[model samples]
Target: MKVKTLEKLAKDMIDYIINLSGFEHIEDIQLNVVDNLESGDMAECNYNDSHGYIQLNIASNMINDIEQAKYVISHELGHILTREFHTYYVNFVGLDDDDMTSICSNVYEQTAEILAKRLGRLILKLYEQKDK
Candidate 1:
């Protein structure tokens, strides 16, 4: 699907962050989860400050494809919600990959990732509602 279509889930995810994290003023940025990438589990990413996105490979291993998929979503949300959730990993000690699994992980990132997971669970709570 087009990135433009994710506005609803993105908004719901953001609200999930605020309600679960009890923070406010978190902007509803753009994000997309495409079926791309290979190896390992799911991967989260951000770009252009305007198009914050998470790309997950539907064919990934069960470790990430099933149970841990939320981490990918939450991890990506971690990037948008806080700067500290990822660790800056340079391919050769310089520029970082957009899929910086540990790119900007700070204390705030930890909190945000945790909150993202919590919100993910809540997504199940309101999953049917989103369709209604």
Candidate 2:
């Protein structure tokens, strides 16, 4: 699909997820489809705590289809949604910021990936049901 189309898809998915999940506190959500990311990542989500908004960046070249795009978008959203739980688990385990090295970050990433996959499947199911 075209870059503009992908951007629109991302925005629509974000709105759908927020409405379905009743996720609040986000003042705005921005979507950017870039040729490539500096980190060589397919997609990334940056949350601005001060502004209560999220910046979602997707590497246009990395997305091959609508399904892949949705997965990437949902995965980034997963990061935003699961952040609090990840922090709580880290603290409950008596780990401080200093202890959050690559390993800790990897754990959080894995958790986010798992949750994102589940969420993506659920969203697809719900969306299909809604149309039926």
> For this target, which candidate reaches the highest lDDT against the unseen true structure?
2
lDDT of residue 46 for candidate 1: 43
1-132, model 2: which lDDT tens digit per residue? 468878887777777777877787545667788888897998987655545566778998878888888767777777666656555655565445465576766686677678877866777565446546
Where does model 2 exceed 4 Å of error?
49-52, 86-103, 128-130
For each candidate, what TM-score against the reference? 0.36, 0.73
What's the CA error at residue 125 for candidate 2, in Å?
2.9
lDDT of 2: 0.71
Clashes of 1: 12
- Lowest summed-lDDT stretch of 10 residues in model 1? 54-63
Point out the worst 10-residue segment of candidate 2 by lDDT. Answer: 90-99
What TM-score does candidate 1 get on C-alpha atoms? 0.36
Per-residue lDDT value at 12 in model 2: 77
